[model samples]
Target: MNETEQRRATQLLQLARNGDAESLETLLASYIGYLKVLSHSQLDPRVRGRLSASDLVQESLLEAHRDFTKFAGTTTAEFTGWLRKILVNNAARAVETHLLAAKRDYRREYSLDLLRQAADESHARLNSMTAVHRRGPASEAEHQEDLTVLSNAIEKLSTEYREVIVLRHVEGLTFADIAIRMNRSAGASRMLWMRAIEKLREAMSNENHE
Candidate 1:
Protein backbone atom coordinates (compact mmCIF):
# COMPACT_ATOMS: atom_id res chain seq x y z
CA MET A 1 0.00 0.00 0.00
CA ASN A 2 1.10 3.57 -0.61
CA GLU A 3 1.75 6.02 2.19
CA THR A 4 -1.48 7.85 1.54
CA GLU A 5 -3.56 4.68 1.57
CA GLN A 6 -1.78 3.47 4.66
CA ARG A 7 -2.48 6.70 6.50
CA ARG A 8 -6.07 6.85 5.34
CA ALA A 9 -6.81 3.29 6.32
CA THR A 10 -5.49 3.88 9.82
CA GLN A 11 -7.48 7.07 10.10
CA LEU A 12 -10.65 5.43 8.88
CA LEU A 13 -10.25 2.49 11.18
CA GLN A 14 -9.74 4.78 14.14
CA LEU A 15 -12.61 7.06 13.22
CA ALA A 16 -14.96 4.19 12.57
CA ARG A 17 -13.94 2.61 15.81
CA ASN A 18 -14.92 5.86 17.49
CA GLY A 19 -18.44 5.50 16.06
CA ASP A 20 -18.06 7.68 12.99
CA ALA A 21 -20.39 6.00 10.53
CA GLU A 22 -18.98 7.79 7.50
CA SER A 23 -15.56 6.40 8.11
CA LEU A 24 -17.04 2.94 8.31
CA GLU A 25 -18.57 3.39 4.90
CA THR A 26 -15.35 4.78 3.47
CA LEU A 27 -13.54 1.75 4.73
CA LEU A 28 -16.20 -0.46 3.27
CA ALA A 29 -16.03 1.32 -0.07
CA SER A 30 -12.32 0.67 -0.29
CA TYR A 31 -12.82 -3.07 -0.21
CA ILE A 32 -16.35 -3.54 -1.56
CA GLY A 33 -15.30 -4.30 -5.12
CA TYR A 34 -13.06 -7.13 -4.10
CA LEU A 35 -15.65 -8.47 -1.71
CA LYS A 36 -18.18 -8.55 -4.50
CA VAL A 37 -15.88 -10.86 -6.40
CA LEU A 38 -15.48 -12.87 -3.25
CA SER A 39 -19.24 -13.18 -2.90
CA HIS A 40 -19.81 -14.07 -6.53
CA SER A 41 -17.08 -16.69 -6.48
CA GLN A 42 -18.95 -18.44 -3.70
CA LEU A 43 -22.21 -18.58 -5.63
CA ASP A 44 -23.52 -19.95 -8.89
CA PRO A 45 -23.85 -17.05 -11.31
CA ARG A 46 -26.57 -19.06 -13.09
CA VAL A 47 -28.70 -18.43 -10.04
CA ARG A 48 -28.85 -14.76 -10.83
CA GLY A 49 -31.88 -13.87 -8.75
CA ARG A 50 -30.00 -14.48 -5.53
CA LEU A 51 -28.74 -11.88 -3.06
CA SER A 52 -26.82 -8.99 -4.54
CA ALA A 53 -23.13 -8.29 -3.99
CA SER A 54 -23.90 -4.95 -2.36
CA ASP A 55 -26.17 -6.68 0.12
CA LEU A 56 -23.42 -9.05 1.17
CA VAL A 57 -20.98 -6.14 1.38
CA GLN A 58 -23.48 -4.20 3.47
CA GLU A 59 -23.89 -7.18 5.75
CA SER A 60 -20.10 -7.36 6.06
CA LEU A 61 -19.88 -3.68 6.87
CA LEU A 62 -22.54 -4.04 9.54
CA GLU A 63 -20.62 -6.86 11.12
CA ALA A 64 -17.37 -4.95 10.89
CA HIS A 65 -18.90 -1.84 12.38
CA ARG A 66 -20.25 -3.82 15.29
CA ASP A 67 -16.79 -4.82 16.39
CA PHE A 68 -14.81 -1.88 15.13
CA THR A 69 -14.06 -0.96 18.71
CA LYS A 70 -12.25 -4.21 19.20
CA PHE A 71 -9.94 -3.53 16.28
CA ALA A 72 -6.46 -2.51 17.32
CA GLY A 73 -4.38 -1.77 14.29
CA THR A 74 -2.25 1.10 13.07
CA THR A 75 -1.30 0.27 9.51
CA THR A 76 -3.34 0.00 6.32
CA ALA A 77 -2.19 -3.55 5.80
CA GLU A 78 -3.43 -4.58 9.23
CA PHE A 79 -6.78 -2.91 8.67
CA THR A 80 -7.09 -4.44 5.22
CA GLY A 81 -6.37 -7.89 6.56
CA TRP A 82 -9.01 -7.47 9.21
CA LEU A 83 -11.49 -6.18 6.66
CA ARG A 84 -10.70 -9.07 4.31
CA LYS A 85 -11.36 -11.60 7.04
CA ILE A 86 -14.67 -10.01 7.97
CA LEU A 87 -15.72 -9.69 4.36
CA VAL A 88 -14.88 -13.31 3.54
CA ASN A 89 -16.68 -14.61 6.61
CA ASN A 90 -19.74 -12.51 5.89
CA ALA A 91 -19.73 -13.68 2.30
CA ALA A 92 -19.50 -17.28 3.40
CA ARG A 93 -22.47 -16.80 5.71
CA ALA A 94 -24.44 -15.14 2.95
CA VAL A 95 -23.65 -18.02 0.60
CA GLU A 96 -24.76 -20.52 3.19
CA THR A 97 -27.95 -18.60 3.74
CA HIS A 98 -28.53 -18.39 0.01
CA LEU A 99 -28.14 -22.13 -0.31
CA LEU A 100 -30.54 -22.73 2.52
CA ALA A 101 -33.05 -20.34 1.06
CA ALA A 102 -32.77 -22.09 -2.27
CA LYS A 103 -33.51 -25.38 -0.58
CA ARG A 104 -36.57 -23.98 1.16
CA ASP A 105 -37.86 -22.21 -1.92
CA TYR A 106 -37.21 -25.14 -4.26
CA ARG A 107 -37.42 -28.05 -1.78
CA ARG A 108 -33.91 -29.29 -2.48
CA GLU A 109 -30.44 -28.54 -1.17
CA TYR A 110 -28.05 -26.55 -3.32
CA SER A 111 -25.89 -28.87 -5.35
CA LEU A 112 -22.23 -28.95 -4.45
CA ASP A 113 -21.44 -31.03 -7.53
CA LEU A 114 -23.08 -28.38 -9.65
CA LEU A 115 -21.10 -25.57 -8.04
CA ARG A 116 -17.81 -27.38 -8.48
CA GLN A 117 -18.71 -28.16 -12.05
CA ALA A 118 -19.52 -24.53 -12.72
CA ALA A 119 -16.25 -23.47 -11.20
CA ASP A 120 -14.39 -25.89 -13.41
CA GLU A 121 -16.17 -24.69 -16.54
CA SER A 122 -15.48 -21.11 -15.56
CA HIS A 123 -11.84 -22.03 -15.15
CA ALA A 124 -11.79 -23.63 -18.60
CA ARG A 125 -13.35 -20.70 -20.45
CA LEU A 126 -10.93 -18.37 -18.67
CA ASN A 127 -8.00 -20.51 -19.82
CA SER A 128 -8.94 -20.70 -23.54
CA MET A 129 -9.12 -16.90 -23.67
CA THR A 130 -6.48 -14.31 -22.92
CA ALA A 131 -6.47 -12.43 -19.61
CA VAL A 132 -5.64 -8.73 -19.72
CA HIS A 133 -6.74 -5.26 -18.52
CA ARG A 134 -5.57 -1.75 -19.15
CA ARG A 135 -5.21 0.72 -16.34
CA GLY A 136 -6.49 3.70 -18.33
CA PRO A 137 -8.78 4.54 -21.28
CA ALA A 138 -6.00 3.69 -23.67
CA SER A 139 -6.77 0.01 -23.08
CA GLU A 140 -8.35 -1.99 -25.93
CA ALA A 141 -11.40 -4.22 -25.98
CA GLU A 142 -9.21 -7.28 -26.18
CA HIS A 143 -7.55 -6.18 -22.96
CA GLN A 144 -10.85 -5.82 -21.19
CA GLU A 145 -11.94 -9.22 -22.41
CA ASP A 146 -8.75 -10.70 -21.06
CA LEU A 147 -9.38 -9.09 -17.73
CA THR A 148 -12.87 -10.54 -17.59
CA VAL A 149 -11.52 -14.02 -18.09
CA LEU A 150 -8.78 -13.49 -15.55
CA SER A 151 -11.24 -12.03 -13.09
CA ASN A 152 -13.49 -15.04 -13.40
CA ALA A 153 -10.54 -17.35 -13.01
CA ILE A 154 -9.41 -15.51 -9.93
CA GLU A 155 -12.86 -15.73 -8.40
CA LYS A 156 -13.16 -19.45 -8.91
CA LEU A 157 -9.96 -20.07 -7.01
CA SER A 158 -10.15 -21.25 -3.38
CA THR A 159 -10.27 -18.58 -0.67
CA GLU A 160 -6.63 -18.82 0.33
CA TYR A 161 -5.54 -19.14 -3.27
CA ARG A 162 -7.78 -16.30 -4.40
CA GLU A 163 -6.41 -13.87 -1.88
CA VAL A 164 -2.85 -14.62 -2.86
CA ILE A 165 -3.46 -14.35 -6.61
CA VAL A 166 -5.41 -11.11 -6.40
CA LEU A 167 -3.01 -9.46 -4.01
CA ARG A 168 0.10 -10.53 -5.83
CA HIS A 169 -1.02 -10.45 -9.45
CA VAL A 170 -4.17 -8.40 -10.00
CA GLU A 171 -3.49 -5.84 -7.30
CA GLY A 172 0.27 -5.84 -7.89
CA LEU A 173 1.06 -5.83 -4.23
CA THR A 174 4.51 -6.73 -3.03
CA PHE A 175 5.19 -9.91 -1.13
CA ALA A 176 5.66 -7.81 1.99
CA ASP A 177 2.35 -6.10 1.48
CA ILE A 178 0.62 -9.42 0.82
CA ALA A 179 2.24 -10.89 3.88
CA ILE A 180 0.82 -8.05 5.89
CA ARG A 181 -2.59 -8.41 4.24
CA MET A 182 -2.68 -12.11 5.04
CA ASN A 183 -1.30 -11.54 8.56
CA ARG A 184 1.36 -14.08 7.95
CA SER A 185 5.11 -13.97 8.40
CA ALA A 186 6.86 -12.65 5.32
CA GLY A 187 8.67 -15.91 4.67
CA ALA A 188 5.53 -17.97 4.96
CA SER A 189 3.59 -15.64 2.67
CA ARG A 190 6.29 -15.89 0.01
CA MET A 191 6.30 -19.68 0.17
CA LEU A 192 2.54 -19.96 0.02
CA TRP A 193 2.39 -17.41 -2.77
CA MET A 194 4.84 -19.37 -4.88
CA ARG A 195 2.75 -22.49 -4.47
CA ALA A 196 -0.42 -20.60 -5.26
CA ILE A 197 1.15 -19.26 -8.45
CA GLU A 198 2.16 -22.74 -9.46
CA LYS A 199 -1.36 -23.93 -8.87
CA LEU A 200 -2.79 -21.09 -10.96
CA ARG A 201 -0.29 -21.74 -13.74
CA GLU A 202 -1.21 -25.40 -13.81
CA ALA A 203 -4.88 -24.51 -13.94
CA MET A 204 -4.28 -22.07 -16.78
CA SER A 205 -2.18 -24.58 -18.70
CA ASN A 206 -4.84 -27.22 -18.36
CA GLU A 207 -7.44 -24.68 -19.38
CA ASN A 208 -5.51 -23.86 -22.56
CA HIS A 209 -4.92 -27.45 -23.57
CA GLU A 210 -8.59 -28.32 -23.26
Candidate 2:
Protein backbone atom coordinates (compact mmCIF):
# COMPACT_ATOMS: atom_id res chain seq x y z
CA MET A 1 0.00 0.00 0.00
CA ASN A 2 1.77 3.12 -1.24
CA GLU A 3 0.28 6.59 -0.99
CA THR A 4 -1.99 6.09 -3.98
CA GLU A 5 -3.14 2.70 -2.81
CA GLN A 6 -3.71 4.01 0.71
CA ARG A 7 -5.74 6.89 -0.61
CA ARG A 8 -7.81 4.53 -2.75
CA ALA A 9 -8.35 2.21 0.17
CA THR A 10 -9.41 5.11 2.38
CA GLN A 11 -11.90 6.21 -0.22
CA LEU A 12 -13.22 2.67 -0.53
CA LEU A 13 -13.39 2.34 3.22
CA GLN A 14 -15.47 5.46 3.40
CA LEU A 15 -17.84 4.17 0.72
CA ALA A 16 -18.08 0.71 2.24
CA ARG A 17 -18.76 2.21 5.63
CA ASN A 18 -21.56 4.12 3.99
CA GLY A 19 -23.25 0.87 2.85
CA ASP A 20 -21.73 0.67 -0.60
CA ALA A 21 -21.67 -3.06 -1.20
CA GLU A 22 -19.71 -2.85 -4.43
CA SER A 23 -17.04 -0.73 -2.83
CA LEU A 24 -16.78 -3.24 0.00
CA GLU A 25 -16.31 -6.11 -2.44
CA THR A 26 -13.67 -4.23 -4.40
CA LEU A 27 -11.80 -3.33 -1.25
CA LEU A 28 -11.82 -6.89 0.01
CA ALA A 29 -10.79 -8.21 -3.39
CA SER A 30 -7.81 -5.88 -3.44
CA TYR A 31 -6.44 -7.60 -0.36
CA ILE A 32 -6.61 -11.17 -1.61
CA GLY A 33 -2.90 -11.44 -2.39
CA TYR A 34 -1.91 -9.73 0.85
CA LEU A 35 -4.15 -12.04 2.87
CA LYS A 36 -2.85 -15.08 1.02
CA VAL A 37 0.69 -14.21 2.08
CA LEU A 38 -0.42 -13.93 5.70
CA SER A 39 -2.34 -17.20 5.42
CA HIS A 40 0.69 -18.98 3.98
CA SER A 41 2.89 -17.64 6.75
CA GLN A 42 0.51 -18.44 9.60
CA LEU A 43 -0.67 -21.85 8.42
CA ASP A 44 0.78 -24.76 10.37
CA PRO A 45 3.16 -26.70 8.12
CA ARG A 46 1.82 -30.09 9.14
CA VAL A 47 -1.60 -29.30 7.71
CA ARG A 48 -0.48 -27.29 4.69
CA GLY A 49 -0.86 -30.24 2.31
CA ARG A 50 -4.44 -30.70 3.42
CA LEU A 51 -5.42 -27.03 3.47
CA SER A 52 -4.62 -24.37 0.90
CA ALA A 53 -3.63 -20.86 1.98
CA SER A 54 -6.01 -19.46 -0.63
CA ASP A 55 -8.87 -21.31 1.02
CA LEU A 56 -8.07 -19.80 4.39
CA VAL A 57 -7.76 -16.36 2.81
CA GLN A 58 -11.13 -16.78 1.11
CA GLU A 59 -12.72 -17.80 4.37
CA SER A 60 -11.23 -14.79 6.12
CA LEU A 61 -12.40 -12.43 3.39
CA LEU A 62 -15.90 -13.86 3.52
CA GLU A 63 -16.03 -13.35 7.26
CA ALA A 64 -14.75 -9.81 6.83
CA HIS A 65 -17.46 -9.10 4.31
CA ARG A 66 -20.17 -10.42 6.59
CA ASP A 67 -18.89 -8.32 9.46
CA PHE A 68 -17.85 -5.21 7.54
CA THR A 69 -20.31 -3.05 9.40
CA LYS A 70 -18.56 -3.92 12.65
CA PHE A 71 -15.33 -2.33 11.44
CA ALA A 72 -14.78 1.13 12.97
CA GLY A 73 -11.36 2.02 11.67
CA THR A 74 -10.61 5.07 9.48
CA THR A 75 -7.06 4.39 8.33
CA THR A 76 -5.57 1.70 6.11
CA ALA A 77 -3.37 0.36 8.91
CA GLU A 78 -6.33 -0.12 11.18
CA PHE A 79 -8.25 -1.83 8.41
CA THR A 80 -5.27 -4.05 7.59
CA GLY A 81 -4.83 -4.96 11.25
CA TRP A 82 -8.48 -5.83 11.51
CA LEU A 83 -8.22 -8.03 8.42
CA ARG A 84 -5.10 -9.69 9.82
CA LYS A 85 -6.96 -10.61 13.01
CA ILE A 86 -9.73 -12.17 10.96
CA LEU A 87 -7.18 -14.14 8.95
CA VAL A 88 -5.48 -15.45 12.08
CA ASN A 89 -8.76 -16.54 13.66
CA ASN A 90 -9.90 -18.25 10.47
CA ALA A 91 -6.50 -19.96 10.11
CA ALA A 92 -6.74 -21.28 13.68
CA ARG A 93 -10.19 -22.68 13.05
CA ALA A 94 -9.11 -24.33 9.81
CA VAL A 95 -6.02 -25.85 11.38
CA GLU A 96 -8.00 -27.19 14.35
CA THR A 97 -10.68 -28.62 12.11
CA HIS A 98 -8.16 -30.46 9.96
CA LEU A 99 -6.11 -31.71 12.88
CA LEU A 100 -9.17 -33.03 14.69
CA ALA A 101 -10.36 -34.78 11.54
CA ALA A 102 -6.94 -36.41 11.34
CA LYS A 103 -7.13 -37.39 15.02
CA ARG A 104 -4.08 -35.30 15.85
CA ASP A 105 -3.61 -33.21 18.99
CA TYR A 106 -3.77 -29.67 17.70
CA ARG A 107 -3.67 -28.16 21.20
CA ARG A 108 -0.12 -29.35 21.66
CA GLU A 109 0.92 -28.05 18.27
CA TYR A 110 -0.92 -24.80 17.67
CA SER A 111 -2.37 -21.73 19.33
CA LEU A 112 -3.82 -18.41 18.20
CA ASP A 113 -1.10 -16.43 19.94
CA LEU A 114 1.58 -18.58 18.34
CA LEU A 115 0.05 -18.04 14.94
CA ARG A 116 -0.02 -14.28 15.45
CA GLN A 117 3.59 -14.30 16.60
CA ALA A 118 4.61 -16.33 13.59
CA ALA A 119 2.87 -13.90 11.27
CA ASP A 120 4.71 -10.99 12.85
CA GLU A 121 8.03 -12.81 12.61
CA SER A 122 7.44 -13.75 9.00
CA HIS A 123 6.65 -10.16 8.08
CA ALA A 124 9.73 -8.98 9.94
CA ARG A 125 11.85 -11.45 8.01
CA LEU A 126 10.34 -10.16 4.79
CA ASN A 127 11.00 -6.58 5.81
CA SER A 128 14.61 -7.44 6.50
CA MET A 129 14.91 -8.85 2.99
CA THR A 130 13.95 -5.51 1.48
CA ALA A 131 16.06 -2.32 1.07
CA VAL A 132 14.16 -0.82 4.00
CA HIS A 133 17.05 -1.78 6.28
CA ARG A 134 19.53 0.24 4.22
CA ARG A 135 17.20 3.19 3.95
CA GLY A 136 15.86 4.76 7.10
CA PRO A 137 12.67 3.61 8.77
CA ALA A 138 9.92 2.97 6.24
CA SER A 139 6.33 4.06 6.65
CA GLU A 140 3.79 1.35 7.43
CA ALA A 141 2.34 1.60 3.94
CA GLU A 142 5.79 1.17 2.34
CA HIS A 143 6.43 -1.88 4.51
CA GLN A 144 3.12 -3.36 3.47
CA GLU A 145 3.91 -2.82 -0.22
CA ASP A 146 7.32 -4.42 0.19
CA LEU A 147 5.80 -7.50 1.78
CA THR A 148 3.25 -7.73 -0.98
CA VAL A 149 5.98 -7.47 -3.60
CA LEU A 150 8.12 -10.10 -1.91
CA SER A 151 5.18 -12.45 -1.49
CA ASN A 152 4.26 -12.14 -5.14
CA ALA A 153 7.86 -12.77 -6.13
CA ILE A 154 8.03 -15.86 -3.93
CA GLU A 155 4.88 -17.16 -5.54
CA LYS A 156 6.58 -17.03 -8.92
CA LEU A 157 9.48 -19.22 -7.80
CA SER A 158 9.73 -22.91 -8.65
CA THR A 159 8.60 -25.37 -6.01
CA GLU A 160 12.05 -26.37 -4.74
CA TYR A 161 13.32 -22.81 -4.87
CA ARG A 162 10.34 -21.55 -2.94
CA GLU A 163 10.60 -24.39 -0.39
CA VAL A 164 14.27 -23.80 0.33
CA ILE A 165 13.81 -20.05 0.79
CA VAL A 166 10.76 -20.53 3.03
CA LEU A 167 12.49 -23.18 5.13
CA ARG A 168 15.72 -21.27 5.49
CA HIS A 169 14.37 -17.74 5.90
CA VAL A 170 10.70 -17.84 6.79
CA GLU A 171 10.94 -20.83 9.13
CA GLY A 172 14.53 -20.10 10.24
CA LEU A 173 15.70 -23.64 9.62
CA THR A 174 19.41 -24.41 9.68
CA PHE A 175 21.13 -26.07 6.72
CA ALA A 176 21.18 -29.43 8.51
CA ASP A 177 17.50 -29.19 9.38
CA ILE A 178 16.68 -28.07 5.86
CA ALA A 179 18.75 -30.98 4.52
CA ILE A 180 16.67 -33.45 6.49
CA ARG A 181 13.42 -31.81 5.43
CA MET A 182 14.50 -31.50 1.82
CA ASN A 183 16.01 -35.02 1.79
CA ARG A 184 19.44 -33.83 0.73
CA SER A 185 22.98 -33.70 2.07
CA ALA A 186 23.90 -30.68 4.23
CA GLY A 187 26.20 -29.27 1.54
CA ALA A 188 23.54 -29.88 -1.06
CA SER A 189 20.99 -28.05 1.05
CA ARG A 190 23.37 -25.10 1.36
CA MET A 191 23.89 -25.00 -2.37
CA LEU A 192 20.18 -25.25 -3.01
CA TRP A 193 19.51 -22.43 -0.59
CA MET A 194 22.07 -20.21 -2.28
CA ARG A 195 20.58 -20.93 -5.66
CA ALA A 196 17.13 -20.31 -4.29
CA ILE A 197 18.21 -16.93 -2.96
CA GLU A 198 19.56 -16.00 -6.37
CA LYS A 199 16.30 -16.98 -8.04
CA LEU A 200 14.26 -15.14 -5.44
CA ARG A 201 16.33 -12.03 -5.98
CA GLU A 202 15.79 -12.30 -9.69
CA ALA A 203 12.08 -12.73 -9.22
CA MET A 204 11.88 -9.78 -6.86
CA SER A 205 13.86 -7.66 -9.31
CA ASN A 206 11.39 -8.52 -12.02
CA GLU A 207 8.53 -7.66 -9.70
CA ASN A 208 10.03 -4.25 -9.06
CA HIS A 209 10.48 -3.59 -12.73
CA GLU A 210 6.84 -4.46 -13.34
Which one wins on TM-score?
Answer: 2
Q: lDDT of each prediction vs. the true structure?
A: 0.57, 0.77
Clashes of each: 2, 0
**Model 1: per-residue lDDT, tens digit, 3-70?**
33333455666777778888777666655544555445444344437666567667777777688777
Candidate 2, RMSD to the unseen true structure? 3.4
Off by over 4 Å in 2: 1-27, 101-104, 131-136
Model 2 scores what on Cα lDDT? Answer: 0.77
- Model 2, position 143: C-alpha lDDT score: 60
- Residue 49 C-alpha lDDT in model 1: 71
Best by lDDT: 2
Those runs of model 1 whose alpha carbons end farther than 4 Å from true positions after fitting are 1-7, 18-21, 46-48, 100-210
Clashes of 2: 0
